[model samples]
Target chain A: MSESAIITPPLSDDDIMKLKIGDRVLITGKILTGRDSAHKRLFDLIKEGKSLPVDVKGQIIYYVGPAPAKPGYVIGSAGPTTSYRMDPYAPLLMEHGLKGMIGKGVRSQPVRDAMKQFKAVYLAATGGAGALIAKNIKSARIVAYEDLGPEAIRELEVENFPVIVANDAYGGDLYQEGIKQYRR
Target chain B: MRRDISHEKIKDTVARLCIDANYFLGNDMIQAFKSYIENEESDTGRDILKQLLRNAEIAEKEQVPLCQDCGFAVVFLEIGTGVCFEGNIIEAINDGVRKGYTEGYLRKSILSDPVKGKNTNDNTPAIIHTTFVPGDKIKITVAPKGGGSENMSEVKMMKPADGIEGVKDFVVDRVLRSSSNPCPPTVVGVGIGGTFEYVAFLAKKALLRNIGERNTDPFYADIERELLQRINNLGIGPMGLGGRTTSLDVFIETHPRHIASFPVAVNINCHVARHKTAII
Candidate 1:
């Protein structure tokens, strides 16, 4: 991979769409956290024509359920949960200007297609590296549904949050490519 | 002949075990992580492995849970027919789970109902699977199963003709299909024979085996080795970033069943593999 390829500008949908597989992304700024429960609630809000707890427009959603924080810690071990559980609701979120997703695992085809149409990217965080990822989250505050436990939505400020381009805007999937390269 | 076991003892043990298992990655799992870091050909895979090892070290030193999802407390109990419990075994287990989860500062993951969502804030009542084994001592094994890998686990019933080959194929297929979802370089537990439920029980029991340990039976051991190789060959790699070493080990536990039945179950465990055992 070229050094230029690794350096992606603060992405807009157009910029995200041009990304190729194997690109390394350093995401800054705000990201929203949601897991199974939060996804359901978000979709329900949309269905009810009620404003979502957090606006998703041109934003990235991370599929994470963080542990409770210790004293002086903003958040506890915050890692990606399985992405497929969010698969059912992701495309709908994408239609509302969701530009990227941060999580692990393969996404459904409709989600992938939505990315192509919306120029979104799917970034994969290391699955078991929760504590490491948590260190990158500078601040976290529960924005909605605090009763959902760890599955509640939280807005976070991240710095150099490490992630890899799993699904690029052009419909290239690293998982499929990785398996095909190694599968005998 | 059941020996009376104290509720306090069970509770204390459960709490200590929960904190220890979550803070410290088992020796076998650590060794597997080290091996993958050294041997993985992909730079990305190696980097991820390094991060995992670092995460384990930080969690241990800081006395924090390894993964954010401390997981649902699953207790596997083997009750001795010769020993009687003074109080309710189920209640003792639940009490212990509550104390452990509370004191450990682990996340409360259990819900009262799957459909009507309600948080059981103490991470209980625990999922207790008990059995009457021929023994004088009671054994408790605690596996704090994370949600990511548990979501990916599946069980299937195959025709008797599928045999060992079919079992192997199914296990590999599941892991491959799981890809990065379950967190690769995983531990795969295969349970064969018995009825459907028994098959699943055996599969989970198989996960209790230490990584890289072989089955006592030579034939089964050989098959385990072959399955491990085939799974690694899938190249799901560490964290599925792509390279070799998708699975660190494959363990199978089996039992006899009816002539016309062939049942197989696959339980996938992530790299964390947080579990500890105690005998009393």
Candidate 2:
């Protein structure tokens, strides 16, 4: 309910501690992008004891597969896809120093527990507002799996990218607590 | 008496509809958002709704997709018995989809195979449902369904004894369990009766109706009203962060079922609610 928190990752432990469920934040700087297809690949790599294409250390992974950038735009319709699809891979990524996840919807309990244990947090942008969200992304380029097209892993440079802290390291969950306050 | 419609004309119309529907959200939803903003108690919910309105404006002005998940094209074709087309109708429709998704810069989300999976790349081979009606004109409706919401849809085979209350409980519980995952402020479509596959289609088709457009049958209209109220009260809110606008509307479409069976389907649509229709 207070003013927005500004975040630029690789977020520090202290930075993760400061976020609370329901707090608004404007994120700047770089973030990694991946979705269902990319998560499956990452999960496979982890199981095979192979190093990832990009380091997971102190990074934020955005659950997105954005439309191809148009002629004059840096990105196109960049918005969070649903997050639960990445649940199977999230805890392991967190263990490897994945400090943050950006997406929409509720996460599994294991993922929430991982956030608390690993000093990580989950944030969600407004879903379905892709065109508006795309404006906040300053640059986007694929970093891996080019053949997967939209589902490819990419790096994005964003500014004032708005999101709400959905899960925090302190075991706070906005999706659960927020609904509790209003559900009749 | 036969009426001729050219394949080229149909293809062009479908292509235009595919692009236009993604850019311009229906006015009914826009008005609903405005009204919901005034009444929504949660600050976050109101803010999200405002962002949605702005998103719509940006998409319209810039001629871009409102959501990155451009959606699976679910086209409904009602071809009149009196109407005639020269070339392959299905081919023309697919060609139109290929043209629209490619030329309009929409994302290619369709996989060629469900399990073996490779991107069709052009968003083709649309899920087309065709019917033969009495008139000479053909009616086409495109409802772009996103995976997030479609994944939440369900079909239930209930016993005759479970009755209406069972139907209500199942529908409400499905939404409750799904909560934020379907992108709240969803549109709930209920299909009662019919075979398994047909019931699912009825639920999906029901979503294409304009906001607040109730069923013509009084009994079913009341059911829609009750379902809407129940869903909104669940407080899933905008994007499921919580508020009073969990669902914009509930649509119920019913058909005669076999004496022994009562089947129901719930098809949830995200707040995007993209559907466009044209008559030719």
Name the runs in model 2 displaced over 4 angstroms: none
lDDT tens digits, residues A1-184, model 2?
4668688988889988988888899999999999988988988999999999998788999999898778999888988999999999999999989999999899999999999999999999988899999999999988999999999999999999999999999999888887898899
Error of 2 at B172 (Å): 0.8
- What TM-score against the true fold does each predicted structure earn? 0.95, 0.99
lDDT of 1 at A39: 93
For residues B169-224, could you state the per-residue lDDT of candidate 2 as single tens digits?
99999999888888878899999999889899899999999999999999889988
Q: How do the residues B1-280 of candidate 1 rate in per-residue lDDT, one tens digit apiece?
A: 5567788888777778777877888988888888777878788788888888998988888777888888878888888889777788788888888887777778888889988868989989887888889977888889988878887778798998897889889999999888888888789989989998899888888888998889999999999999998998898887776888798899999999889899899999898888898888
Just chain B of model 2: what TM-score?
A: 0.98
Judging by lDDT against the true structure, name the best candidate.
2
lDDT score of residue B132 within candidate 2: 98
Model 1 clashing residue pairs (backbone): B1-B82, B2-B83, B2-B84, B3-B83, B3-B84, B15-B100
C-alpha positional error of residue A78 in candidate 2 after TM-score superposition, expressed in Å: 1.2
Q: On a 0 to 100 scale, what is the lDDT of residue B195 in model 2?
A: 88
Task: Single out the weakest 10-residue window by summed lDDT for candidate 1 chain B.
Answer: B1-10
